[model samples]
Target: MEKTPSACAMQWNIELERDLRSKKPGKSIEAILDIGPRLEWWSRESNLHAAEYKIFGLIPGEDKLFANAILLRLADAFKSGDKHMKICIVKIFLSELKQRRQLRGQGRKDEGILSKDKVDSYRELLTRIKIVFDSGNIEERALALVLFGCWAHIAKDSADVRYLILSSLWSMHILEAKASLFAAGCISELADDFAHVFLEMLGGLLVSSETSRTIRLAGGRAFAKMWCPILLADIAHKTGVNLILESSEEEFSLVMLVSLSKIASKWTPLIPRQVELLSSFMTKDRGLSLQVIALKCLRFILTKGMYHFPANSNVTLKLFGVINQLDFPPALHFDALRVLCKILPPNLDTIPCTEILTIFSKFLQIVEFKLQSPVISERVFAIHVLACIFDKLLGILKDRSGIGSIVSSRMLTFTFDRISY
Candidate 1:
């Protein structure tokens, strides 16, 4: 339970802000750091006020003393501070939270006089922050939630903070997207009460064309980068996959596909599902960005061998059409070709050996055209992809006797006509 701010604490809050602002250089504010954490009226108001300023007024430094002193009374200030003052307190606490994370990252122990009994103290401080967060106005609540998400990496009591985060994220305020992404990254311990609502909200944002593109993309990115990993942490695979599949917008789906490919590398069963779903977006009509991302994700999934891709003639032919089209960006062109290469040894009945050779032959003509262009990278990328096709093609021609004469004869004629270009 959190303590309500007493009248004396409110008075000290004023004095503290004032004294720190007025404190002159070389004045010993050490007395402020020495004041015990207890909020007692017996202590002179002027002294606590001076201490408060002394601790907060100084710029943060490597030394933990000032940070520790401020944290000691921070919860009290949070309970009593006015709106602006509360924001200031939130800033200081968040800064300390960042420093704590940095210390852990550096492999340094939490070292300071006040930090000797750190766990209990920091936990209590976070509890106070949570109390303030629950009771603050919109701006205050959003800011406090951001602070919690920022510390999501190290906070042990995150389960307590998760629902509040979900509420803020659900509001879709300008602040919600960022705070949600941060929380999604940090709050791996989120409860299903929070996760269920959050996934639903993200799904709606991602699927809705009415939602701002920025927010939609952020939702997709957050789900893949942060939410998927966390939900999958405890075997909640269906929840994450379902949300992604439920989205309707092309951009949102593309963003989610890219995110899923990055995180789902170890989750093999998901690869084909992602590939199959993303294949629809690899069409001539999809936006270049969506097409590129979808194809890239498909390529990534196949290259990683995350799943055994059984051949689908319809999907294979669609990819072939995307490859055959000239309107998509060159990178996407390469990605589409790469996807074809990855799903090689396709079931011949579905994606026939002859059809594969024909695609590669046309693919060569595309590359040969690029080689004469000024963009050296595209030329180089195209040549590299073309080379890979030939290498793969040669092996296929050698292994199978049925299409050897026709494919080899056509390959020779195509090579003679375009290889020098």
Candidate 2:
């Protein structure tokens, strides 16, 4: 009986793994050579798994001979194969290039540096790549643009390459998903002279719904790679917080907020002012998950972030309001309380102690009511919140003489009553 494609694929994986594991020299190269015929057969059947395998097989550089031979075949395919074949081959080369660069950057022994001749060969191959990049087909063009970013170092000094990529990025209609992702990926490779332009562009996309989620997500990931804190701070200064706050996509805006807090320790004066706007997110018509994300953003800003959140009593008041509105259980409410605590350090005497006590008393009432129909988990979370609030207030009351009164004693008694349960 003829072997099924499924069986053939399985046998092929087994043989490749065996060759990869074999102690015999040249056996891996033999296994790679065996792929040439299979490539033709797989291409005839349009088998994506086979195509994916072909690309992944060349990722490890354990055998330079096998890897180089596979790379050369892929280049040949790029030149001679049909469009689908070209795309698959280029993707393989790009993935291998990234793996090699990552390995080299970490000071690991890599597929030894490309020889001068090999460098020249790749540079020449790039001329052919440009033809596909300018292809009429959008997907092919998108993939080609990504390939350019992958091999960006080869053409780092080439003005023509920079213009081609930048113009594509600026174009409104270019590969909507992929081209943007690859373009963002190449921002670090683009000329430093255009660094501001790239930052502004990425910042805009970081909040824009016009970009695909994958591309926006990619933009956020690439933001860390392309710019440092100083540059990021400068970009945030230029972009303004309102743009991020008014973003049509809630998740994307939250990502931008997280990235902003992470990128710099320096408080741009505008950042504290923006916290009011950010606080409003807790009250937005959104889900608990999104509210959780906003709470995390606030926590990041107050705790890990360098900027000091303004000690406005109103911000605390608004947060407590959010806690009251939260439909989620007490456990999830912990995030909001955590953010409140970060802002409510004993030093924040600007916020009236009376107002603070009222907030805690209201929360105790809610906890006491819930305790009447106790869920063990919710009850535990309620206890945790009560402890944090009491501990915080105890420290403040000891420092401020007039702040502790008969009302404070009753608040303590009420808290202790709940805890005894």
Candidate 3:
């Protein structure tokens, strides 16, 4: 009887293992070359998992010959196999790289260092990936951008590799927005030598009215990952403010806000400006979705750098205005209350009686309005917010000060009324 395809594949896996165990690099390489076509065939048949598992399983000892074989097979897969095949090969490469990194961390210095042969094999793989990048369909090119970025991270110390990666950034304009995003994401790894050039490039894309929202967001994320002070300053001085106040696109505003939030811990000098921008979104005129995102960004900024929040009364009153806007969606209300909770000090002694009364009155109004809501969830949410407010200000509420006495009495009346219901 003719051997089934699975049987043939199994037989090939067995022989491949034997050759690897024989401890002869020449024999193992030959066996890998011999099985290359079979692996490609299996990938085409959508049975790549078995062959991939067997091959990876047999090569865990950092066998140089196995590494070469894997690279060669990767090239073959990219050249002829389907998209799934190419993706599987890329994942294997990444997984192997991660495992090697872990080994290095464990003090396996020899295994961690890239030998000359290993570097050469990676160079060959990069060449093949670039070829696909230049000529492949959009999906393939997007995948290639990811592979290129990973290669940049792995070969970061090499000047030649850095140059190659930088050269790809110029071609980003020709690619679709999604592909360009992948390329943008890779810039953080190359920021040491090429930060200024990339900053100008990414910054231009971020602030340009003509740039797509997707690309703007991509640039924002890239800046967030870099954590460079210069980049952060540029974002604060120009890109973020432009998006927040000038751009009509809500998504662009949201992307910039998110980017700012990620770096909020280090953005003390610009906290007031950020608060001003976020307050604009919290107004009744803005869309609910944008308001919600603004509230979240505000919360992150307040929680991470509360000491930096501007001490101005205008800023405090604007936040109070957010909670008092009963017409806003429940989500906005909840997030706004959360932001208020973050900004309010646990020890309220530093605040004056009039300011505390202002805050307490606004929150009391919110609780009163929400309690009367016909929706059970709204009432529950009100209870939760009230509990949070009480928890946060319990110290002052229990004090003998006149402000505390007034707040305590009002809270008692509300709590008793809810219980009676």
lDDT of 1 by residue, 1-421 (tens): 2322222343444455455444465221322332233222121121223334345443223123333334546555555556665556545545544555466546655332323332345666668778777787766666666666645533424567766666565565666555655665455433344555566666565556566767766666665533344445223334445655675566656666777666566466665565666777667676667767777777776676664667575566677677666776666656665665556544433456757766656666666666776778767777676667666666666767667666677667766877566
Q: Which scores higher on TM-score, 1 or 3?
A: 3
What digit string (tens of lDDT, one per residue) describes model 3 on residues 106-143? 55544321344334577676677767867888677767
On a 0 to 100 scale, what is the lDDT of residue 207 in model 3? 66
Name the regions of candidate 2 deviating beyond 4 angstroms.
Answer: 1-128, 151-157, 170-178, 189-191, 199-229, 237-240, 244-274, 284-293, 299-311, 326-332, 341-343, 346-350, 362-378, 405-408, 419-421
Ranking by lDDT: 3, 2, 1
What is candidate 2's lDDT per residue for 21-102, written digit by digit as tens? 5668766456555654553343233222444445544332222333234344445445555666556555554555566557
Question: Residue pairs in steric clash, candidate 1?
Answer: 16-49, 20-53
Give per-model TM-scores. Answer: 0.61, 0.61, 0.66
lDDT of 2 at 257: 61
Clashing pairs in 3: none
Clashes of 2: 0
Residue 158 displacement in candidate 1 (angstroms)? 5.2
In Å, residue 98's CA in model 3 sits off its true spot by 12
> lDDT of each prediction vs. the true structure?
0.56, 0.57, 0.59
Q: Point to the candidate with the largest TM-score.
A: 3
Q: Candidate 2, clashing residue pairs? A: none
